[model samples]
Target chain A: MSFKAAVLVFPGSNCDRDCKVAVERSTGGHVDMVWHQDTALPSGLDLIVVPGGFSYGDYLRCGAMASLSPVMAEVVKAAERGVNVIGICNGFQILCESGLLPGALMRNNTLKYICKPIELKVENHNTAFTQGFTPGKSVWMTQGNADGNFVADADTLNAIEGNGQVVFRYVENPNGSANDIAGLMNERGNVLGMMPHPDRAFEAELGSDDGAILFRSLMERVAA
Target chain B: MKAKVHVFLKPGVLDVQGKAVEGALNGLSTVQGWANVSHVRVGKVLEFDVAATTAEEAKAQVKDMCDKLLANTVIESYTIEVA
Candidate 1:
């Protein structure tokens, strides 16, 4: 079975092409690059990727304006219909702003734009995105953001932890995220939002290939 | 009427930018002999004109905007003033 994917591209989204290339390389499938103003996504998509970068020039907030884009309304609907959604970097901020995922991405504790390769531990392997990794396995990927710190209220944080919604945790707590969380999934597990740029790590020449497992895992599920 | 909206990070939210500004101020105080400052927090203000006739109507409309967009509410609070 062939997997179909779409990568949403906002005006300032710099990672859309990389995400498209990564998806195509991992699944050997063509990826449609959808613009933010487009009213709808392609039909029968197995996956929707909200790629990284400073959307709308990071005005007001990193992803606040982008979350209100026309395409995001459809993305929210697709997520509700159980289509797998992966939000990376600024995409993670968009997910939170869209209310598809809990918590907010706050400015980094150090007040810096952190750009580095970081280690992430797979906290849950039951979801489509993490099935390729063993529980507690560490994967290396590039993460860069000024507002990658994940913040949620205490009760919400507790609930997320209890419900196994955490998909990844920073091995070294790079941005001072609450509970060291690097990635999260919605309650239904089909929607995921993460800070790391897995698309940037899909090839060995890019420094590591650990990120391919996430795409491969989704492809495996779609084929099954 | 014109409205001004003040948005602030809620207490206990760990304002990193505010902290950095406070640290810089403290360093300036020691070096340049300025007065000591404490509990320095940063917030944003947005001013815009609304078509509402009465001050109450303008405040209500601006409050709605704050609730819907200007503030996250989960981590930030906002105040609206109309004149």
Candidate 2:
């Protein structure tokens, strides 16, 4: 079975091409590069990836303007219908700003733009994104952002953790995120938002092949 | 009528920029002779004119804007004033 995927491209998104290439290579499937201005996504997509970059030049707030783009409304609708959606780095910020996921991405505790490969532990292996990995397995992926910190109220934090929604956790707590959360999934586990760039690590030539499992897992689940 | 909106990070939330500015102020205290500056918090203010007849209407409209877009209520709180 072949899977269909789409990579969203906003005005300032620099990682769209990376995501498209990774998805195509990993799934051996056709990938569409959807522009942010387009109001509708292609029909019958198994996965939608919101790649990283400074959308709208990080105006007002990171991902704040991009979240209101025309295509996001349709993306939100697709997510509600249980289509697998993954947001990486700035895309994660957009997801929170768009209300597809809860909480907010705040400025880094160090107030600096950090770019490096950090160790992440798979916290849950039940979701479509994490099912490829064994629970507690460690993977190193590139994380680059100024505002990568995740924050929420006590009640919301409790709810997400209690519900097993957190998918990845930073082993060394790089960005000072609440609970060292590097990634999380929605209540239904169809939508995931994470600060690390799995696309950047999808191949061995790219320095690591740890991220290929995420794409492969998506394909396997959708084909099932 | 004119409306003003103030957006600030909630208390107990770490304001990294605010802390940086506060550190700079402390550095200047010995050289510039400034005194009694203990802490600092940074926020944003947006002021605009609205086509409302009364201050109450303007405030209500601004509040709606804050809730919808101006502020991310998860990590932020906003106050609106109309004149």
Candidate 3:
């Protein structure tokens, strides 16, 4: 089985091409670039990606406007059926805005646009996304803005932990999330929403290649 | 009919974004430290103008809308009242 993925693109989504390149490289050129205006996702796709960049120019809030785009309607349907979905950076914001993922990613505590490579801890190793890595190791994190810390109620937080939904955690609490949460998975474990850009660290030249393991894991699951 | 929906992050929810905003405002002197802004809570008040003839009907439909979309009970809690 070939690994099929679609990278969603929006008006201000600067990282679309880069994300498409990374996914294509990872999946051996089996990735499709889908526009945000499209009404439906290609059928029987194995994975869908909402990539990074200041979509809608961060107008009302990051991902707030893009959440209402016609394409998200398709994404929500794809996710509900257990099709693997990944949201990175502003994509994470859009997922939250679209209610595919729980809680909201608010502005950073420092109120400054943060762009750098930080450390990440592989918190959950059971999902289709993070199982390729060692259960507890620090990886590299790249890209984010002021509104990046993830917040949810105690019950929702408990549910996430109880269900093994916390996928990745910031080792140093880079965005000040309550539990240093950098990424999460839905209850079904099919939908992954993360603030860091794994695409940025997928290549050896960028610094660390820890992020490649994520794509490798997804591929392994697809091939199985 | 006019309806008001008061939305708030649920109790026991950590408002990290709001806490940081409070701190920043304190630093900028918009509020005194630990006094004027001991804690900052953020929420939205959604006002709706409905065409329902009766207040009860508007309230019921508005409540459904609140439950279906406007509020996320997992992270956000909301109250709906008709005017």
- In model 3, the clashing pairs are A106-A147, A107-A146, A107-A147, A108-A146, A108-A147
| Best candidate according to lDDT | 1
Best candidate (score: TM-score): 1
- The iRMS of the candidates, in order, is 0.7, 0.8, 4.0
Tell me the DockQ of each model, to 2 decimals: 0.73, 0.83, 0.28
Off by over 4 Å in 3: A57-61, B1-83
Alpha carbon lDDT at A27, candidate 3: 64
Query: What order do candidates take by lDDT, descending?
Result: 1, 2, 3
TM score of chain A per candidate: 0.98, 0.98, 0.96
* Candidate 2 deviant stretches above 4 angstroms: none
TM-score, cand. 1: 0.97
Residues A137-205, model 3: lDDT tens digits: 778858656778888877888999898889888878766686889999889999999988888888888
DockQ of the two-chain complex in candidate 1: 0.73
Q: Write the per-residue lDDT of candidate 2 for residues A54-74, one digit (tens) a residue.
A: 999998788988999999999
DockQ of 2: 0.83
